[model samples]
Target: MGTQFLTDEKGNKTAVLLPIKKYNKMIEQLEDLHDIKLYDEAKRDDDGTSISIDEAFKIIEEKRKAVK
Candidate 1:
């Protein structure tokens, strides 16, 4: 994607202009980065307990049966 800079009278770049598609892609990348940081922080925190996949599936099935 191409970028254009909005400059001031002094020839200093003040802002940037990018295509909407490029801007949206950048936003999505930033969100992904944020999610990765959250995951890293969760990994560092030892206080959280994790459940096995089998146990989780069983619990979900039980809930579905109850709803029906």
Candidate 2:
């Protein structure tokens, strides 16, 4: 496994540690993402909330309407 520091346009930094295969997979997925934001949200426990892809889309739609 290897570790690397990644910097954003704004000079923010992130440290990622992964095996070569995992790193390549991440690179492939990141290349497909036009914009990606990484953040930490508050949670009550280590095993936090879980939602499926369909549920995520529904939540996005609900939030989008409130912004309109």
Candidate 3:
């Protein structure tokens, strides 16, 4: 929602920014993708509600492979 200036070890700065609404939407999309993968893996049954970021990416990779 707000902008921030990040300084690297070399003291170079870059502005990072995002709108809160957009960020929330991105989070929701990631969560939905994770839920689908968990369901596929049988690690969740009948509407389970939590997922780790790592698990999400693994699922994403699997999905990507399938598409290819």
Candidate 4:
């Protein structure tokens, strides 16, 4: 493994070190997993309600105005 670790005086693993390429790939994979989880949750929460893009935009605009 192209991995290393930073240890404390007590030989405890404090931090990890990985190649920049590996770190980036890990981050991308985590992001993809997060997206999948969100999609699954949304599907589970679905109520069969549908809205057009125009109505969605209008609701967003109303909410933005309320925030200000």
- Expressed as tens digits, the lDDT of each residue in 1-68 for candidate 4 is 69999999999999999999999999999999999999899889989896877999999999999999
The true-structure Cα RMSD of candidate 1 reads: 2.6
The full ranking of all candidates by TM-score, starting with the best, is 4, 1, 3, 2
lDDT of 3 by residue, 1-68 (tens): 46566877887886556788877998999999999998787763535676888999999999999999
State the lDDT of candidate 2 residue by residue for 1-68, as single tens digits: 46666778887886556688988888889966634323232233336567777999999999999999
Point out where model 3 deviates above 4 Å: 1-15, 43-68
Which pairs of residues collide in candidate 1? none
Ranking by lDDT: 4, 1, 3, 2
Model 4: colliding residue pairs: none
Q: Assess each prediction's global lDDT (C-alpha) against the native.
A: 0.94, 0.70, 0.82, 0.96
Instruction: Report the Cα lDDT for residue 23, model 2.
Output: 80
Q: Model 1 Cα displacement at 14 (Å)?
A: 0.2
Clashes of each: 0, 0, 0, 0
The candidate 4 region of ten consecutive residues with least summed lDDT is: 44-53
The CA lDDT at 1 in model 1 is: 65
In model 3, the clashing pairs are none
Worst 10 residues of 1 by lDDT: 43-52
Estimate TM-scores for all models: 0.71, 0.30, 0.42, 0.72
Candidate 1 lDDT over residue span 1-68, tens digit each: 69999999999999999999999999999999999999899779857688777999999999999999
* Runs with alpha carbons beyond 4 Å of true place in candidate 2: 1-48
* TM-score, cand. 2: 0.30
> Which regions of candidate 4 fall more than 4 Å away from where they truly are?
51-68
